[model samples]
Target: MRSYHLSHSGAGLAGLTVRTHDAPVPGPGQALVAVRATSLSHRELLVLEGSYVLPVKPDVVPVSDGAGEVVALGPGVEGPAVGDRVMATLFGVEHLAQRGGSLDGMLTELAVVDADSLVPVPAHLSYEEAATLPCVAVTAWNALTGDAAGVRPGDTVVVQGSGGVSLFALGFAKALGARVIATTGGPGKAVRLRGLGADEVIDYRATPDWAAEVRRLTSGRGADRVVDVAGILHDSVRAVALAGTIACVGFVGRTAEPLDPRALFASGATVRAVAVGSRAQFTAMNEVIAEHGLRPVIDRVFPFEDAPGAYAYYAGGTSFGKVVIQGAGSPAGIG
Candidate 1:
């Protein structure tokens, strides 16, 4: 099977190249998937840049989000039969009772996922769409619901940025009937976010103190939940909530700043850093998505051979939704 691997240059994703390799045969308890499509998240940039602590091998396959069909299953694998449509969860382990470790990468024409890590794709979703769910989608779900911390109706939730995780948060929050407040750096995105069911939108670029605006919008009550994807705005997050739960999931700003412990103490708020989510969470999320017929927003799809180009497009940050690379001869399905 044809595959793409990291080049020797260590030049990040820009160093990725396409190459032909023998199709992987399933090993014991594993399954070989005929990958249909894979989606990109901003966090992949961290992996490519070697900033993430995962310590990826120089020539290892990149990416951790995709959907495919079971072509074959290894010995003792009976759950997913051949031709079953499935998506790979980030962590092969279903439910890690504790935190640590990372999920497998899924950017390729095919992937070898443990059978237990696969989630059945909803019959209503296409491979391209299902490809978008595993990583960011599950992370958003866990942030809101997986920890037994359910977001209730009428609660005010804030989502920062218009990226994959934030968008998922907005969608999930909306499904729970929670009022959503989304922030975007672009004015156009603010409009788009409102259309995505956000009750309110803030243009961070126009209003640097967007968090304060969030507080004002809530009549000084502050948001009940804030999903912070913009690391630079962490302090802003601290300013916007009254005893809110803040889930830090990204570092779009790429800088570290001093945080006031007093602020958090004063508000009696909790700040938690999320590293995506578990396979169990992925399964739970898929169920909700299928139930709601929620289709993930896909910004663009590139041919498999042009996977590198897909990364370039993602780097440009021009897309409003997920960017994907479809496997050869595979049909596009946006879930």
Candidate 2:
């Protein structure tokens, strides 16, 4: 088996190196999967920088989301059968529900995973699209429809930025019958956002006070829900309607402005810090994706050998959607 290891934290992509190891076999209640494709998340960048809140082991294989096929099942593994396409769940069910614990890594050609942690990929989706779902898709789904911030039909949603989570939020919110307002720093993304169901696109670079623009767009009522992917909580506070909900999902910005208690009290809004959700949530999200034929927006796909290049491209901050990596077992001609 081949995998990329992060030799040390804080050294960025330069610290990652390829290594070979004996393939892992499944244990009891586990399944052996031939990994076909994987995707990068912003969280991986934080891990590389040694800034993620959760502690990561040095020299660990470094990815959380991947798609593959079930090749062998261990004793008592009654879940996915041989030849079934499956997606990796970053967290175990209990861990995700209680403490938001995630797996150390999934960047390997072959992995032994608990059968219960795998979800069957929708037949309509290719391996690359399935690989992108386990992390950001589930997170966005939970942010919009989970207990903290449930969006109803005809409600207005404000999604900050055009990253993977933001785009997924836009698609989901629209499918759920909400009107969407998307904010982006790049003017070139306006057309794409609109195509993805954004009713209005606000260029944050052009309009520094984007919250005000959101208010104006909604006739002063403000958005019912704000997907705060940019992590500007104060701005999300200002942008949401009275009694609305704000899903705090990312920290793309350098510094978050302090929240003013008085302002929050006056606005009567709720702020929920969202983590990538549980197996149940992932299953539900996949159901929606299958029903709606929602394909993830893929910015680029790099071959496994170019894992370092993929990291460098993600760091460059110009991609409009999820960046995927095709594994050795990926279907020929897929990317």
Candidate 3:
């Protein structure tokens, strides 16, 4: 089996090196999956830069999102059968009942995963698209629909940036019948955001006061839910409606400013910090994705050997959606 490991932590793609290892057989209650595709997230970038709060062990597999087929099952594995398409749950076994567990990332050609941690992929989606769902999609679902912020029909949602979480938020909010206002950095992404179901797209670069624009678009009511993937907490506080919810999903902005207590009090909005989610949440998200026929937005796909290049592209920050890397064992037709 071939795997990409984070051999060193630095500022560039040089840290990730491909290495060969003997594939292992699964133990009881586990399944052996031939990895088909894996996707990158901003979290991985932070890990590479040595800025992430969670310490990644050296030589660890370094991507959280992957989809593959179950090739074999160990004794007592009674779930997915051979040939069933499955995606990994980001968190490891212990996190299924708790919060804040670390992920055993999936950047390998083959993985032996706990059978309970795998979710069946929808029949309509390709391997690459399914690979995008485990992290961003589940995180978006957890942020918007989880206990932190239960978005109702007719509510208004404000999603920050055109990243995976923001785009998934747009799609989920629209599916829930909420009016979505999305913010992006430029005009080109504004058009793409609208096409992805954002009712109004704000170019944050042009209108630095995007919170005011959100208020204007909402006729002064402000947004009921703000998916703050960019970590612009102050702006999210300003744009959120009174008693609304702000789901803090990312730190892409690298902002260092402390939250103003006065602003939070004035808005009366709840600020919830979201982790990716549990196996239960992942399953629920998959159900919703299948129900809505939601095909994850994929900006590009790279071959397995070009995994480092995939990280480089993601670091360049121009991708409109999830960037996937196809594994050596991936079906040739998928992409």
Model 3 clash pairs? Answer: none
Which is the better candidate, 2 or 3, if ranked by TM-score?
2
Q: Show where candidate 2 strays beyond 4 Å.
A: 93-104, 332-335
Query: Could you tell me how far off, in angstroms, the CA of residue 94 lies in candidate 2 after the best superposition?
Result: 5.8
Provide the global lDDT of candidate 3 against the true structure: 0.84
TM-score for each model: 0.92, 0.95, 0.95
lDDT-superior candidate, 1 or 3: 3
Clashing residue pairs in all predictions, respectively, total 11, 0, 0
Candidate 1: minimum summed lDDT over ten consecutive residues — where?
95-104
The number of the candidate with the highest TM-score is: 2
Candidate 2: tens digits of C-alpha lDDT, residues 21-87: 9978788998888889889988888878888777566687888888988989999988799999999
Q: Which residue segments of model 3 deviate by more than 4 Å?
A: 9-12, 96-104, 332-335
lDDT of 1 at 21: 77
lDDT of 3 by residue, 117-172 (tens): 88998888899999998888999999989974488899999998888998898998
- Residue range 1-335, candidate 1, lDDT tens digits: 67777653246766786777788888999998998888888757766676754555556677778888899889989789999999877766545311112433566666777888788998888888888888788888877875445688998999888789988999999988899988888878888898889899988789878778888899988888888777754565555566678877777866747667777778777777788777677777878787888888889999988888898899898898899889888865534
